[model samples]
Target: MTSIAAVTLEVADVAAAERFYSAAFGLGSQVRLRASEAATTGFRGFSLSLTVANPATVDSFAASALAAGATSLKPVTKSFWGYGGTVQAPDGTIWKLATSEKKDTGAATREIGEIVLLLGVDDVKASKKFYVEQGLTVGKSFGGKYVEFATAGPSPVKLALYKRPALAKDVGVPVDGSGSHRLVLTGTDAPFTDPDGFTWESASSLTPAP
Candidate 1:
């Protein structure tokens, strides 16, 4: 089955982007997969991997992004809610940093909450059919325009189908092109919405499986 893989970006310098992210978020290091000799590395985390460009052996376009504006938004620091960092890339894109550790709730069971993913679609029925055939079971159907899907059993992943215009109205954003959004959920692939049409997915709050 086809799944969303990586969200790529273009950057100017690998080292500069690395330092920019590390200094801003206090992240660790990573080496390139194919280009061991080339100047490339990525960050960790499901949301990590700030790709930098190679001057001599440039591979992807992300290397070009470092030249945009890449500025520091929030310096590396910890907070009551969680550890945090923030940066604005050269392209004027904002990136936030938070503690990767799962918080302890001081209870016998794990807690559960909602984590939503927004996906772009040209036809809701077509997309829904595709996902259903892939073993993603439908939980609730919101008329012909919207459908909710769950993994299986007491699944952690929840999929919501939303029309592009409806979603834009809900968020109070003008129905323009889709910008960028992050859906932080465990045991699921990252879902990205298209420029205008989008998909909405959610995750149940973590809870004890019993």
Candidate 2:
């Protein structure tokens, strides 16, 4: 079994990224990497998603992220799937906050119930195959458009792949150009890139439990 133990972002200012994420999402400081400003350009090819227990929590978190300096990519609204919105963190990482359940009133907390790393891949089939070879078990999949993988243990973050254009459209972003996705997946044995150039890194500390 395999799990995306963590999703690390390469940012221009590690300290700034750490501050924003902690203030905006209550995430800890371990998920950031310091890199040159040139590291972020063009489409990142992926987005981070936060799943809460209800719609009120979704809106609360979205508003908090904006107040904490994130750019709103999409506003909170009711959709076929649920209520949610997209925001770009200070370091160029796009985040989606959503929940299927609806609640009329409640205060939003910095705490998140779950997080998923969504990859926008050029070829879903190829990317799926690559991860499968790396020992990740498939959870749910649709023809050439979306696929979900099972988490190996108590991993906080889940992983999924969707067609690039569809992903970009969902997040209200353009799908063009080549640059670092600013994403890194640790807990694997070696570093590698998928079909669309999303990189993954291996860290022994992140290895999943048996």
Candidate 3:
């Protein structure tokens, strides 16, 4: 089965991006940085989701990200889904810190539970089918609206799909965007680009699995 080994982010400055990631979220090796001059604008068609234990942890991560030079897209707010917020990193990547739990289980900590790479696509069904063809197992599905893929990669980053417009709204961004996605997925499968133009390459081992 196909599994993502690393999430490589194409940035203008790899060193600066490295610093921001370390200082902001301390994501470890889940994210990789590569220098690129690819032209990109607007939403970039994806977001990195950071799931925490409670509202307090979400707040802490948000505060840390902002302090590390991430631009605030949406401040932390509670919703029916959970408590969360959106922030844009200095490297132009969007991050959503969220938690399904509404209440704080205990004192807030710097621990992060899961990381899901949410790719905004034009068609969920088509994309889902394409991924299945590539050997990714379907972990969850909700018709044409969303799909989550189960993975067995060494570096564990889960994968999920959502409509472009809907995903943009969830991340608090405008739908209009063009040019390079500025993102790449390194996985165990042979190199190929998905229907939405996300490139997946074969890698030995990496973080953020699916």
Q: For this target, which candidate reaches the highest lDDT against the unseen true structure?
A: 3
RMSD of each: 14.2, 3.0, 2.5
Q: What TM-score number comes out for model 2?
A: 0.90
- The TM-score of candidate 1 is 0.35
Give the poorly placed runs of model 3, Cα more than 4 Å off.
Answer: 204-210
Measure candidate 3: CA RMSD: 2.5
Predicted candidate 1 versus true structure: per-residue lDDT over 55-78, tens digit per residue: 111111122223334454454343
User: Cα deviation of 171 in candidate 2 (Å)?
Assistant: 0.7
Residues 66-150, candidate 3: write the lDDT tens digits. 9999999999998999899999999899999999988888877878898999999999999999989888899999999999998
Across 67-131, the per-residue lDDT of candidate 2 in tens digits comes to 88999989989888878899988887889999886554566655577788889988899889988
Clashing pairs in 3: 155-209, 156-208, 156-209, 157-208, 157-209, 157-210
lDDT of each: 0.37, 0.79, 0.88
> After superposing candidate 1, which stretches have Cα over 4 Å from the reference?
1-112, 153-156, 178-210
How do these models rank on lDDT, best leading?
A: 3, 2, 1
- Candidate 1 worst ten-residue window by lDDT: 52-61
